[model samples]
Target: MFTIARFLTTALVAILFLATLPVHAQDAAPAEAVAAAPAPEAEAGELDGLENPNIDAATLTLRLIPLTAEELEKLSADWLAIVRASTVDVVDEQIRINNTSAELVEEAARARLTEVTESRRALFDKYSTILDAWELKGGDAAKIAGYRTYRSAIIVEETRNTDWRTLLAQATSWVVSADGGLRVATNVGIVLASFLGLLLLARLVRRTVRHWAGRIPNFSKLLVGFSALAAYWLTLAIGLMVVLAALGVNITPLFALIGGASFILAFAMQQTLGNLASGLMIMVNRPFDEGDSVDIGGVSGTVRDVSIVSTTVITPDNQIVVVPNSSVWGNVITNSTASETRRVDLMFGVSYKTPIARAQAELEKVVRSHALVLSEPEPVVRVNALTDSGVEFILRPWTKSENYWAVYWDLTREVKDALDRAGMEEVEAGAPPVVAPPTGVAAAS
Candidate 1:
């Protein structure tokens, strides 16, 4: 009975402990649920974490948080600053490069321009020196490059007296450029003016020469004409040179070129040049005047014309002959008309049987009694030759140059008439009369 009571007490105690434990656990469940549930502040902190990465700092500085408008403005401001800085840097670099390039170009231009200017100045100085020299030597003013320049005067005189007016007339001035070129415009104008003036002066000279020539009737008209032409040509040439000088043209090169070309031409045309030179010599030397009877190159004739290349002559037979000036100058010239009077020689043949003394006396009387015969040089008749058939008598007489032919013809006819009247038969009855040569001289065996 005691053991059953003890086991029932133990069972009841175990059931009571089980029931108490359930009740305590139920009370703890409420406390644990309450602890696990988050507080409002802690939940707010978690909400802050969603808005900012640092939740604690975000919670501590709530007022410091940026608004949407502030954030946009700050971002825009930063972007604008970066853009402005970049643009400024780029612009500065470009400006620096441009400045450097411009400076280099300016320096180069200055250097080149300076070199050119200096070269021009040097050339100008050289030209000035030449001009100064010209002025020192008595120069004149001339236009060069649209500016007035000094030119030197060169005077040439043909006479002893150095007349300034005459020298000025012959003087010429030249405008020489720095490069040795000559200005031709002024020279042409000067030459034209000078030629016109010289023409007027030449007219005066011609009148004077003509008056003088006319006063001398014996002077040849051809000679006077030639002299006038020569004077005119000389004056024209001199005037041309003076005009060229006045116009400021440099004649050095022109003269040199002309001289060289002339030399070449003279050498090439040697025969022509010789003929022309001889002609000029003849013209100047006056070997024979016009109307003078001359024998040239074995040809005897009266001079009709004297020309540069040839001479024209009219023979006594009325035949015309043209002789080259070269031939006349090269050969001997005989001037028959140079003297006031001339002599005539007559020859006659008579039969050998006739008396020589009687023929001589008769011929002398005929020659002396002739009206044209000159008394200063006495007339003479002489027996010259004894030949095969006859005796030759030579009759000589002096007469005026104009009457030579008339006296010769008249004396020959009168002597023949007198011989015929004297009964001198030309032919004998059985023998041939003493035949004479055509020249009235006895023929030689």
Candidate 2:
């Protein structure tokens, strides 16, 4: 029993010793880690000292040089402090030299400006002498961009050196006053001269165009008129430009305004412009001249008058029609009078038992007998078809365009009459007669 109790006490003591050993081992590990850690700040300081020994001292005495006036103006008070904190080296000698150069450049610019001002003033004085000698009035003086300017009235006195005596007398009596007041008179004279000049130019242009127009052929009257109008417009445009220039109005702005206005007008009247263009094309190309009978866009009529916007036509029914030129230009046009004559086709059918050769001969005779039918083109009578009702024959004959309806009616009636007589004789011999139905009835029925 004593041996067992001693053994248990020794085991208890050994377990307690093992637990305390773990706690001491944890404490010793932390101590060892603390001793092994390096000093990062001290290492950085050592490296910095080795690489640049006088870095801080040099930074304290450093100065920056701005190359331009703008750069110097943009430099804030803190900019120098920030630059001092930076690693980049700035030399004091360079900064001093740049500052001195900028100050000298500013002083030189001021001196040059003063010299230019003096020169401009002398030139202004010379121009003033000329202006004063002219005895000009109703004008003011102004300064622009450091230069003196004398603005004269747009209106000026009208003087005739050749008639100096008369001009002097007129000026003294009516125009000039005791104080030499001729401003109003000069303005009125200029207005009168401009009005008369415009009138004279217009009259001269009209006379010149009329003279040339009379010499041109009647067929070319439209071209001549168009040319004259274009020339007048060109002259007016140039004259307006010259007048604007004389008035000292800037032309560049006017050009933009005109361009914008023209664009708006063109966009607004696109259809009208198309019609006008088409009319011009028709006139120039001579697709169909006046008095010609044509079928245009389902309208069959004789062309009466062709205008820039529309064409006037007189239909065969005596109705007057006005068609837009664009419609005429877009559609196909068939001119009946282009060939002076047209072919008229008439179809007739006889009984199948009726001799085709005999019917063709009779039809040819009827067509040739009509005076409206053209003899140059012989009539053709052909068996077109052996239809269910009877034998069909087509009579093709040429006639003058003006006589188209007349020839067609006359030949049709004559051919039927001749066929009826022949059929009647055949019916009297106990054979059936093939007579066409009444005028307004359907032939097929």
Candidate 3:
């Protein structure tokens, strides 16, 4: 389609150039001889009579170059109407060929189709030739330019769709022709080279972003990864468009199509977009990072990955869960590893008659003995509650975020053993059993 339109336009320019050339003195004798020559008669039942006088007037008007913008526009409108009528005629002829069983009738309908198509091409060519001259002469009105733009678009569209077999045959022929083959080879080489160059450039950009991101204060792994990945893709996208434009490919239509498609997709993918926005917010706010223990929307796990649409979490029991970013952001996000140090809270009960002072001392001793526990904050062990069957002591110990679970579990076991060794009796059977901390502490993500 593209090649055919260019060919027609080129042919039109050449014909107009020859017609406008000045006659030489030696050629003047040809005028009298040409006037004396008889006009040829039209062939019987030929389809050429289908030409409209309005189209003829428009074609004749195009011979006068550098017309005022308004006159050019009027001529453009006349040609556009003729072009539309020709399209309708072609469709009507195709239907005539389809509905008939007579071979002669189908053949004749095809002949009319060819004539109407040629007439449409001529109208386009003449109008385009004039418009090119108008613009060259500095008649650059927006409406005049619009006519040429729409004309080319329609020509390209029709050429592709009018006949697939003919379009394919032309395309194959062009691909094998000397000039066309050379042009195709050049473009292919350009595209291949551009792709390789852009790929390397994108990778370099990603590495650069990652290196720079680490130096940024408070930038988390999630933010760094997202930025580098985004930079990589963005570089490729812009670079490809630049390469295409340099190759004489028009990208404006592609952008327009993408804009239209985005408008429709906005409504269709509302939830996904919500997740994307939430993911960005999560990254920006620095609520959590990769490997952080998080409890979001009732799922407790280590954050394995964070993407624009979803968060992948690997649970302690080895289950992988994917939560949408919207859910992650919308819920209360508890990041246990977000802080440098975390407090492990525990509750244990014993017989009410047990010595409170002795138990407190024993619990404190067990906490302080743990290797990973931090000492600056000082562990706290005190009688917290008087239950129906026993007394409860609350033990709070500070430790590095990474060793929180180890510290909590170790102290619980060690404290139990220590108390028993010291002859501490268990709480009555009705009392609550020794259990891990509440859900808040367990997830503390």
Per-model C-alpha lDDT, please?
0.54, 0.53, 0.69
Which residue pairs show collisions in model 1?
173-245, 175-248
> Whole-model lDDT, candidate 3?
0.69
Q: In model 1, which runs have C-alpha deviations exceeding 4 angstroms? A: 1-194, 206-227, 280-286, 317-319, 425-445
By lDDT, is 1 or 2 better?
Answer: 1
> Compared with the true structure, what per-residue lDDT tens digits does model 1 show for residues 248-269?
4455557777899999998898
| Better-scoring candidate (lDDT), 1 or 3 | 3
Worst 10 residues of 3 by lDDT: 22-31
TM-score of 3: 0.62
Model 2 ranges off by over 4 Å:
1-260, 424-445
Candidate No. with top TM-score: 3
The collision pairs in model 2 are none
